[model samples]
Target: MSKRILITGAAGFLGSHLCDKFIAEGYEVLGMDNLITGDLKNIEHLFGNENFVFHHHDVTNFVHVPGQLDYILHFASPASPIDYLKIPIQTLKVGSLGTHNLLGLAKEKNARILIASTSEVYGDPLVHPQTEEYYGNVNTIGPRGVYDEAKRFQESITMAYHRFHGLETRIVRIFNTYGPRMRLNDGRVIPAFIGQALRGEDLTVFGDGSQTRSFCYVDDQVDGIYRLLLSDYSDPVNIGNPHEITIKDFAEEIIKLTATDQKVIYKPLPKDDPMQRQPNITRAKEILGWEPKVDRAEGMKITYEYFKSLTPEELNKKDHKDFSKHIRK
Candidate 1:
């Protein structure tokens, strides 16, 4: 019998890519998503594949896996600020109740589970080049807290499951990842800049644009996640490219790449924004024997091409003017 794996949020940017990876490896893949922040277009290409099966269901409710399972990757959370703000309660429910529901399934099926954690847990971190050991300085009541605290709570319970239940669990702290399939209007920096540049709109920069962030390509992120699932790294391990860049310089690069004459506009920064973020992937290197091979310029080029393929109307409807300053409450 072939191995079967369940991937929550399988229609999402990273989740879709993971579905491709697992299917390519010859495992039977069960992709589950409620299409909340995820879109069907992202996974439509795989609909005809015999090895792939998709379920339009929310994991926050009960999940019923039909066949024998080998792994469960819990990645169903509203990641972007735009998303969580608009659906704060659903975001919290998915991360908290959804995770608990998945853990229950994992226990019954005896499958290894991987919970997708985030670098936000290190919120506005006091330490630079954040290592896995640094506890975060996060605002519990801030606009971004709904998403951040939910993830923090997710990690807490996942660890408890491992200690108390002896159910094998893995946690990966992902950083700023970008690629195709990301909603152009999700308010993430990469897609926002690319969308504006593509349409000849001024690129918005928040707070002088000096905040630093690292970017990891989708392929590299999936590579590290795959390694972690096969390995024994139960604690939360940071999986991201350690290459850090300023928001100003990043926008400048995008403008130049697109050869857009659009001006850079400044906006007020959101509350409790992190000044710097870079992952310390020393553990990933030593344990998973992995590191991101794609550089920023190369990754950006690929993502830009994907955005260029969309029609003007599609771009306009999906792209918003500017939501960087706004926070979800």
Candidate 2:
């Protein structure tokens, strides 16, 4: 019998790709998502695979998976600013309550669990090129606090389980990752710029666009996560590209790639937005022997092609997901 694993948020961009990766690796994969921010279309292609099973359930509530489970990847959460700001309570619950439930399940099944953390935990860092040991500077009451605090709390609780219960746990502090299956209007930089260019609209750059970010292709991110899961390191590992670029330069690159005759527009930066986000991946290279292999030009080209393939209806649709039913009272 093949090893069995459960992946939450499996219908989301990264989760869906993970589903494909695990299935290709010959694992019996179980995918769960609430569709709050996750679209089933991302994972619909895997519905026919005999090794794949999907559960349309919310992990913030009870998560029950029968049979022997070898591993669990806890990835259920609203990752973007737009999604988390709209559903703050749900976002908090998924990271806190949802993580607690999954931790309990992992302990029960004796399964090793990996939590998906983000660069948001670093907030607007005072440190350059964030390292694993750098304590973050975050505004607990800021608008972005809902997501950042949730992830910070998730990491805390995950460590508690690892130390107290002796449960096997892995944490991946993912950085800016982009690739196919990304929602065109998801409020992420890569997709947002691409969407504007594709529509022949001016690219929107916030706060003079000096803010910097590093992009890691989804394949590289997944590969690092896979290696981390299998490695013996139990502490948090940063899985992202260290190469950084400013927003203004990135916008110019996007404009050139799309060949759109549009200019760049400036807007006020949002509250608590990170000014610089470059990961220090020395730990990843030394421990996991991993570093992002995809260059920005190649990765951006692939991402642009993915966005260009979207239908006119999808491109124009402001909000593709309906959160009415998922919003809890």
Candidate 3:
């Protein structure tokens, strides 16, 4: 009998990709999501596979595990600022109650669990290249605080479970990642730029556009996640690309690739925005034997092509001006 793994938010960008990975590897994969931020179209292709099963359920509520599970990948939180801000209470509930529920399930079944964490825990970090050791400088009451604090609380509870119950738990602090199947209007930088370029609109830059961020392609992120799941690490590990680029430069690169005549438009930066966010993946390299394989330019090109496949009307509807408003330089 093949091993079974439960993936929360299986309809999400990363979660969908994980579903594909696990199914391709011959595991019985159960994908669960509420379809709030996740879409059914993302996982539609997997319906034909015998090993894949989809469940329309919210992780914030009690989740019933169907069979004996070998692993559980908890990635059901509201990820984007626009998403979490719009659904702040749900975000908190998912992070706090949802995580606790899943941890309980892990303990009940003696399954190893991996919680999907974010670099936001290192809120507006004081360090240049943030490592797992650097405690963040986050604002608890700010708008983004709903997501940040929720994730911070999630990590705290995860640690408690690890120490008290000895539940085999893994936490990954993921940085900015983009790829195919990502919602064009989800408000992340890559999709935002691609959407604007495809629509022949201005590529808006926030603040002075000098704020820098590093991006990891979806494939590389999945690779790192896979390695970490198979490894023996219990602490939170950072999984992201180390390459850094300014928002302005990143916009320009997208424009150049898409050949869009769009110009740059500057806007006020959002409150408590991190000026720089680059991951220190030394632990990933040393422990997981992983490093980001795809560069930003290459990743952007692939992502742009995916955006280009959408109809102009579909692309226009997702115009995410406010999402980028906060992260502007």
Candidate 4:
């Protein structure tokens, strides 16, 4: 029999790519997503494959999977600022409640699990080129705190489970990742700029656009995650490209790539936005023998083509959700 694995957030951008990766490797892949931020269209191509099965359920509730399970990748969360800011409580629940439930499930099945953490944990870092050893600088009560604190709590609980229950766990601190299947209006920088350029609007840059970010192509990010899952190291591993670029320079690159006549526009920076985000990938290279293979220019070209292929409706669509029903007082 083939190895069986469960991946939550399977309909989202990174999760959907993971589903494709494991399925291509001949594993029995179980995909679960609440579809709050995940779109089915991303994973629709896999429905015909006998090796892939999707469960449309929220991980915050009890997760039930029948038969043998070999691995679990806990990736269910509202990742973007637009989504989490709109539904703060749900963001908290998935990282706390959702991670707890998945860890429990992993223990029950004797499966090795991986939890997805993010660079947000290092909010507006005082340290340049963040490392795993560096404790982050974050505002617990700030607007971006909803996502950052939840991920911090996630890493805490995951480690606790590893120590107390002896559950096999892996933690990946992912940096800024971008590619196709990204929601154009999800409030992430890549998609935001691309969408504006496509719509013939001036590219919007917040805070004079000097803030720096490193981009990891989706393929490279997935490769690193796959390598980490199979490795013996259980501590957090940073998976991202280390090549950094400023927002202003990146915007000009996009304008040139798209050949758009629109000029760049500026706005005030959001509260607690990280001014610098470059990953210290020495751990990843030494441990997984991995470093990003795709450069920004090549990766951005592929990503831009994917966005240009979208229909006019999808291009203009905003991913706003009615979270009032899900929000608690």
Each candidate: what lDDT? 0.91, 0.93, 0.89, 0.94
Q: Name the regions of candidate 1 deviating beyond 4 angstroms.
A: 318-329
Total backbone collisions, model 1? 0
lDDT of 4 by residue, 184-279 (tens): 889999999999999999999999889999999999999999999999999999999999999999999999999999899999999999999999
Evaluate candidate 4 by giving its C-alpha RMSD to the native, one decimal: 0.9
Positional deviation of residue 261's Cα in model 1 after best superposition, in angstroms: 0.9
Instruction: Name the lDDT of candidate 4.
Output: 0.94
lDDT of 3 at 234: 96
Q: 144-225 in candidate 1: lDDT tens per residue?
A: 9998999999999999999999999999999999998888878899999999998889999999999999999999999999
Model 3, residue 136: distance off in Å is 0.2
Each candidate: how many clashes? 0, 0, 3, 0
**TM-scores of the candidates in the order shown:** 0.96, 0.99, 0.96, 0.98
State the lDDT of candidate 2 residue by residue for 1-329, as single tens digits.
99999999999999999999999999999999988899999998998999999999989888899889999999999888888888888999999999999999999999999999998889899998999898899999999999999999999999999999999999999999999999878899999999998888899999999999999999999999999999999988999999999999999999999988899999999988899999999989999999999999999889888888999999988877777765677
Model 3 over residues 1-329: C-alpha lDDT tens digits? 99999999998899999999988888999999987788788999999989999989888788898669999999997788678777778888889999999999999889999999999999898898999999899999999988998899999999999999998989999999999988887768888888887877899888999999999999999999988998999999999999999999988898899997899999999999889999999999999999998987788888888888987677878633233332223
| Model 1 alpha-carbon miss at residue 174, Å | 0.4
Ranking by lDDT: 4, 2, 1, 3
When sorted by TM-score, best at the front, the candidate numbers are 2, 4, 1, 3
Q: After superposition, how far is residue 221 of candidate 1 from its true place, in Å?
A: 0.5
The alpha-carbon RMSD values of the candidates against the true structure, listed in the order shown, are 3.0, 0.8, 3.8, 0.9
